[model samples]
Target: MSQTPRYQEIRDDLLARMCDGTYPPGSLLPAEPELAEAYGVSRPTLRQAIQLLADAGYVEKRRRRGTVVRRRKVEQRFMDALMSYGADVEAQGAIPATRVLQARIQGASPEVAEALGIGEGDPVASLMRLRYLDEEPAVLLRTWVPTSVFPGLLGHDFEREGLYDVFAESGLPVETVRRVLEAALPDPVEAELLAIDEGQPCFLFKSVGRAKTGQAVEYSVALYRGDVNTFTVTLTTED
Candidate 1:
């Protein structure tokens, strides 16, 4: 029988070591020359193995840091239930903080009106927020609510309280939300706001949230950093 490819063999061994905690997250692996020598493979073969790990989000190569294992990606189960971004990060043992970038009342645009089931030119409370996980900028969020549903929402302190909490306190909780997720390259403005390179890939989430009575009450557009964030949805099929 033919032998397993050298690169694949090396890659599998490294993955096993990582899984067994030999290569802990945020820890640097041995230098390429050392690894190549230890594995009895050429430098190119070792690099090919490491490249596979990098592509799978297992490690990152830095200029001065060599190859370091990456922390697990944050998973946002948007389909399972309504969850605050803060809660999701906190559940992963990371600090969650919010910065209120902008809040004001504005006339609804055509798209916003359609999403919120309001007429064009009607007043809406517009909120722009930046979310941070462990002090790293993670998501930029823009949400609009019909002024008729939650008057004076702009007066609340969004930086300290989550939007969902604010809405629930005002008797306008979002019972159901419909979301459309798409892969996008960030614009210059988004790149600056998210502290990422221009044209970096991001996940764009456009959602319409409905009240328990089935009234569309909120429309939001959120951009999440693709590097550190991942979305998971569970699917089931009966045999």
Candidate 2:
């Protein structure tokens, strides 16, 4: 192979090391300068190799912390179905729990109204929660439900179970959910609640779940710890 393919070769070698448990999960790898010297390549070439590893989910780059090997991701199926967060976590063999921080009836903010497709000033059930996985805080979820669909939802104790479970118990059938994911810096409140330092990046998700009749039932905005969780989507060709 040509020397131009050297970066690819380096990336492959590093990946092999990871697979063979040389670096192990959560272990920091050598700096670019050290790696470049060891591999007989320039810093840019070494960086390109590192980028390949990072993109493949084998490693992560933190601001103050150096590059570290990532733990194996929990493989979650994205089937076209509605499932509760508790069920999903249990399927992965992890204990899940939710702590309700706040629950109340609130007027729809402009952002909530746009997402839920409801008029401004309409009443919405605002539910804020801190979700835990195996007793570790994993995500901060804030959801708004149009009161017109599920009246008096704010009166229930959501900390004991997921909102989707309550919906099913109330005879609501969720047929479709639209989700968007992005990265954002956690705000002060979010940072405190999520137990993350300020300016740290978090995965932000906005989801709109609708009933079988196509009426929007819930709009949720969630922040997940970037270091501990990852979202995976699988695509197959439809015949």
Candidate 3:
């Protein structure tokens, strides 16, 4: 067998430590230089090893605190009935909360327009929020709804309510949803909002929700922290 790359070897060792409780969850690993010296590798190589841990949801790189063993990721099953982030987390025995960052009427971008089946530049209610699970930053969520579908949407308080609830209150029934999932590195803004090191991996979920009559009601994009959230998809075979 080919030799394991030096960085992978280091990463495996650290992962072993994490699994054995040598580095317990929420506990810090040794400082970078010390770890580097122990592994007989350059700091850059050590960092690569650490980055691998972070990307795999095993650890987090926090400023001033060093690398920390992460808690087990919260599992999000895509096959579950569509619900609010709060509901999803609560069902998993975690507390869920939201902090609205921005909520206002704005012109839809081309992407939003396409998703919502509206004209480009049409009026839409845009909402941005930072969602938390057990008081830890977990997801950065942005959603757009056509003003024509729900007028005065901006007048509602989203920090204490969920977008799905808002839609229901407006008598808009979501008939279908199409979603796309991908992995990406957080941009500077996302990194700041999520309290994660810049360039850390995140799970991006983008969806368009339509009303019963085929009118698109919502266009949403959510970024889940890679180190703390994992999604599962279930498939069934026909008899």
lDDT of each: 0.88, 0.83, 0.86
lDDT, candidate 3, at 176: 80
lDDT of 2 by residue, 1-239 (tens): 64658989999999999889898776889988899999999999999999999998889887656897876544334334567778877888877789999998989999999988999989999999999776667789999999998997987888785688788888996778998889898888888887556787788889999988888999999888877676667678999
Model 2 regions more than 4 Å off = 1-81
Using all chains and alpha carbons, the TM-scores for the candidates as numbered come to 0.74, 0.68, 0.76
lDDT digits (tens) for residues 58-166 of candidate 3: 8877876688888877888654567767777788888888999998899999999988888999999999999987777889989999999898888888888777787
Assess the local accuracy of residue 212 in candidate 2 as a C-alpha lDDT between 0 and 100. Answer: 88
lDDT winner, 1 or 2: 1
Each prediction's total of clashing residue pairs, residues at least 3 apart in sequence or on different chains, is 0, 0, 0
lDDT of 2: 0.83
Q: Which predicted model would earn the best TM-score?
A: 3
- Pairs that collide in candidate 1 are none
lDDT of 1 by residue, 16-83 (tens): 99999999766789999999999998999999999999998898876645897776678887767899
| Candidate 2 colliding pairs | none
Ranking by lDDT: 1, 3, 2
